[model samples]
Target: MKVLVLGGDGYCGWPTSLHLSDAGHEVVIVDNCVRRQIDHELATQSLTPITDMKQRVKAWQEVSGQTIAVEFGDLLDWEFISDVVRRHQPDAIVHFAEQRAAPYSMIDRRHAVYTQHNNVVGNLNVLFAIQEFVPECHLVKLGTMGEYGQPNIDIEEGYIEIEHNGRKDVLPYPKQPGSWYHLSKVHDSHNIAFACRIWGMRATDLNQGVVYGTVTPQTERDPRLINRFDYEEVFGTVLNRFCIQAAIGHPLTVYGKGGQIRGFLDIRDTVRCIELAVENPAEFGEFRVFNQFTEEFSVNQLAEMVVEAAGKLGFEARIDNIPNPRVEKEEHYYNAKRTKLLDLGLQPHYLGDSLLDSLLNIALEYRDRIDPDVVMPSVDWREGRAKQRVHKAPAQPSASL
Candidate 1:
């Protein structure tokens, strides 16, 4: 199968591209290196350096003997995107292009606007281009678990069947995203669902969660193939932040009472989920939504787990109760049914201490790369705040796109 992997230079995208290509499917990865550019602008680099896009493709070719093509350009450009669809005529298109950091989305007006335009327009263009070029091609889009933000009810996969009075209706799952980034993803889902109905296209929106860990069998420690690891507040995820903090001997800053809970996944599982979606193509005119996650954990539970894991390393993990930067629920009910992916044969990789230890070993290599100043609560989601995070993240992953 021929596949096009968008945002292929990202943390998940790169590994995913390699995973698919290694499976003997012809793959082409398209990325503008916008994340690297944004990180440079923000003066915050990944904990480890990533090679240039061209070099990465070359390395993968040498390593796997796979000729995964490379393209460097923005997906927001309609013509450029359309031309890729016209040229590649791929069997499937994996759309991972978007601004994905919640804090970065809330950083300032500029970042917020970029997140809106880049995510919405990118997904829309992909829909339009695919509709015009390869109507039969399946579009595997990355939506976010944050879209169903701590709802009072149990979240179902994609759609919900409502029995109001005596009437019954099945519709897209309700969304209440906390940040602009997640909101943009919700908008992307809406646009694609609308387009799929109108254009008779195939699209799968994987509502994935905050992903952690960074190793896959395809890679060992090639800096060129090293996944983009963001440790700063702007792009660092909660678990990743906690793990890096412990590695650097910094106190894990738990905002509020630390009872906030959400679904989480390993980066390896993220790649597998994408592959599962690609292998099981959604039918034409179908807006299939799958809740993608291995398991759920509260913020405090994750913090405690990290602290305990640090103790194994002969390190004293301390906690600092910092005031919440973002205005979100300190605690809420989060039970999402994710049997679809499992039905499609998705093998999940749960978070264990061994996994945490493996991640810690990686973080230790770049311990000096961490800027302790950037780990604190620097951004607030509310309007008009003095402590809003200043850095802007490019965009990221089945995700807040």
Candidate 2:
């Protein structure tokens, strides 16, 4: 199958591109390299040194003998996306190109507007290009679990069957998106579903959870092919941040009650899930949704796991109960259904002590590169309030376990 991975230079996109190529699919990656520019704007870089697109593609070819074609352009540009789609005429286009940080979206009014504009416009352009160029192309859009935002009721996959006044109807799941970034995703879902209904386009919206860990089978082939590991407050997931804190002897910063439960999956499983979605596409005129996560964990539970894992490595990690910056439920009912991917032959890589240990080891190796400044919460969810910045203290020696 010919596949095009948008945002192919990103943390997840890079490895997924290589994985797809390695699996004998003709792969083409389209990216604007805006993520690298964001790293520059934020003054923070990935914990793992990432290669440029040419270098990354070259490394993958050297390691796996599979070539991945690359195209550089902004997804919002209709001409660029349409040209790529027309040229490639791919069977599937995996969309991961977006400004994906919740905190970044909440940083300021300017950022919020930018996040919404960039993400929403980019997605709309992709849909238009697909419609214009390749009507049969399957769009595997990367939606977020955050779109469903901790509703009290058990979350269904994409849609819910509700009966009201002797009438039964199925509708897309109710969205309670927390941040502008997530709101953009919710908008994308509506647009995609509408397109499918009206234009007979096919799409799969993978409502993915918080992804952790770094290396994948294809990325592990070469040092240059390594995926990005972000441990900063804005971009990092809780588990990844915890592991990095443990590595550098910083206290595991738990926000508020630290009982915010969320679904999670390893990086390896993320790529596998994408593969499953690519292989089994949605029927024409159908917009399928899959909850793409293996398991669930709260912020406190993740901090505890990191502490225990660090203990085995002779680090007595401590937990700090910091005030929650985001206006979200610290504790909430979160029962999300995620059986679709599993049924589609997804063998999950569950979170374990060994996995945490391995991540900690990577952090330790890159410990010197960590900026210490980027490790804590800086963006406040509250509007019109001053941004609170926490600086990472010097790493203390591990106490005797």
Best by lDDT: 2
Query: In model 1, what lDDT does residue 372 have?
Result: 81
Question: In model 2, how large is the Cα lDDT of residue 251?
Answer: 92
List the candidate 2 regions with Cα displacement exceeding 4 Å. Answer: 384-401
What are the per-residue Cα lDDT tens digits for candidate 1 across 1-401? 99999999888898999899878889999888888877865667888777878888888878777888988888877889899989999999998878788877887666777788888988888888898999999999999999988888999988899998999999777889999889999899999999889988989999998899888887664557777788888788888888899888888888898989889999988989999999999998999999889899998999998888888977878888788988999978778898999999988988888998888877888898888877886677776333433543333421342
Over the full model, what C-alpha lDDT does candidate 1 score relative to the true structure? 0.85
What is the C-alpha lDDT profile of model 2 across 1-401, one tens digit per residue?
99999999998898899889988999999998988877766778899999899999999888888899999998877888899999999999999999999987887766767777778989999999889999999999999999999999999999999999999999889999999899999999999999999999999999999999999888888888889999898888888898888888889999999999999999999999999999999999999999999999999999998888888999799999998989999989999999999999999997887888898899899999888888888788886232545222111101210
Q: Which TM-score value belongs to model 2?
A: 0.96
Please state the error at residue 171 of candidate 2 in Å. Answer: 1.0
Local distance difference test values of all predictions, in order? 0.85, 0.89
Question: What's the TM-score of each model vs. the native?
Answer: 0.95, 0.96
Q: How far off is model 2, as Cα RMSD?
A: 6.5
Error of model 1, residue 311, in angstroms: 1.0
**Candidate 1 wrong stretches, greater than 4 Å:** 384-401
Number of backbone collisions per candidate: 1, 0
